[model samples]
Target: MKKRTMRWASAGLVLSLFLASLSFVPSGSGNASAATSKSMAALYAQIQNERAAKVVALVNKERAAAGLKPLTVHTNLSKMAKDKAIDMFKNKYFSHTSPLYGSPFDMMDAYNITYRYAGENIAKGQKSAEEVVEDWMNSPGHKANMMNANYNLIGVGYYNGYWVQEFIGK
Candidate 1:
């Protein structure tokens, strides 16, 4: 009970911090409510532009020395991002009869997570799985997760367009 309570408290604190760090546009300010169509890469570029200026500078500095192209990366968004994503898969997504037992998730080292799924079912009235992932990746929880993992890269790999879902950490 004590352990569980502590975990809950920590989660709450981290979640609070994550929310506090979020930058929001005021209501009806700068097309905040309007739906502007943008491709995934465009949206990602925008997020990188706004959220990762420091990363951009560092990457440029290093790449200039190495004569390599600069890179933009995504880090975890919140403290609970990975945990919540894993739990969502274990409790809500994966099939109960899966051979992997309780969760088809593997923490592939301190920073990476991989999941093998026969299939996944999103909760009733919830967004599709892709949307869920996108939201989670962009949430405050992702940063928390990244910090905990001591990772600097945010990447997702789908093998053969099925079976394997690998979350990358660098």
Candidate 2:
């Protein structure tokens, strides 16, 4: 029984060593692979930007129907919203407040965004920008943020299945 146990241990050690060594192996494509990865990353960023823009447009349409002025997209606020979405997706939590980043206002402060009035809306599992915006508009709290005349700046972020919208006004 002891000998059998020893053999099993030896086999486990060998397997571990083999797996560890695999990490050191070169992929052969090297710089070409890295360049491709960079290009793919840029393409993905562009797609995400487009999706975010679509969300803004849809939100603006909703506001227009309600006779509210369209909110301009704030770049810093967008960065903050994107960071929140990424944080929520990575940490697997969906809420206006994040364990890592605190509330939306906190995130805005971190991004150096100043506003006298601000609001945030978050959603998950929506397949498209329209769907997510519709979901938000259906919710009273989110709809208020969307239609609030006090808000003059907007930021949107979509990552994976998570969506975040930040609203701000002077």
Candidate 3:
């Protein structure tokens, strides 16, 4: 097991270096920026409006389940969330070993997922964001990792069809 892990570690290091090099290469910067903006615009709008409430609720719910006190939008947690994300990015496993480095945008995705679900629950008259998070933690697809030292729970989003994808890409 030790030998296997070492081999995987070396491979991951090589891959990360390769990807980092690729990301630094100059290749029509404007196109990439435009494409990213176009792809992310809808998601941005969704999160700001509809999904924001749900995500806040989900995080609050998870906090409650972990025996931590619940937080709110106006809570100190809103600012602390970004701090936690930076800490996650600095973890040795991510900074040294994993080829897939965590990014703020990725953290935002998790936030949006939680917020969207929480908002939906509110609309359905499910008052407890903590309950929503607890149910999600018990869900089949939730994955736990040591990387989540600060931000414990992150949501997984599913796509039902290609319509949204096509719309976003176009």
Choose the strongest candidate by TM-score: 2
Kindly report which residue stretches of model 2 are placed more than 4 angstroms away from their true locations once superposed: 1-30
* lDDT accuracy of residue 44 in candidate 3: 57
lDDT of 1: 0.37
Candidate 2, 111-169: lDDT as tens digits:
88999999999999999998999898889988999999999999998888889899999
| Per-residue accuracy of model 1 over 1-170 as CA lDDT, tens digit each | 99999999999999998876654556765643243434555685554333334333433454446554443343432222233334445565433233333332323323343323211211222223343334433555432332323333333221111112222333
State TM-scores per candidate: 0.21, 0.81, 0.25
Winner by lDDT:
2
Clashing pairs in 3: 54-114, 54-115, 54-118, 54-119, 55-114, 55-115, 55-116, 61-130
Query: Against the unseen true structure, what C-alpha lDDT does each candidate score?
Result: 0.37, 0.91, 0.37
- Quantify how close model 1 is to the true structure by its C-alpha RMSD in Å: 18.2
Q: Where does model 3 exceed 4 Å of error?
A: 1-52, 58-71, 90-132, 135-170
lDDT of 2 at 164: 89
| Native-structure RMSD, model 2 | 4.4
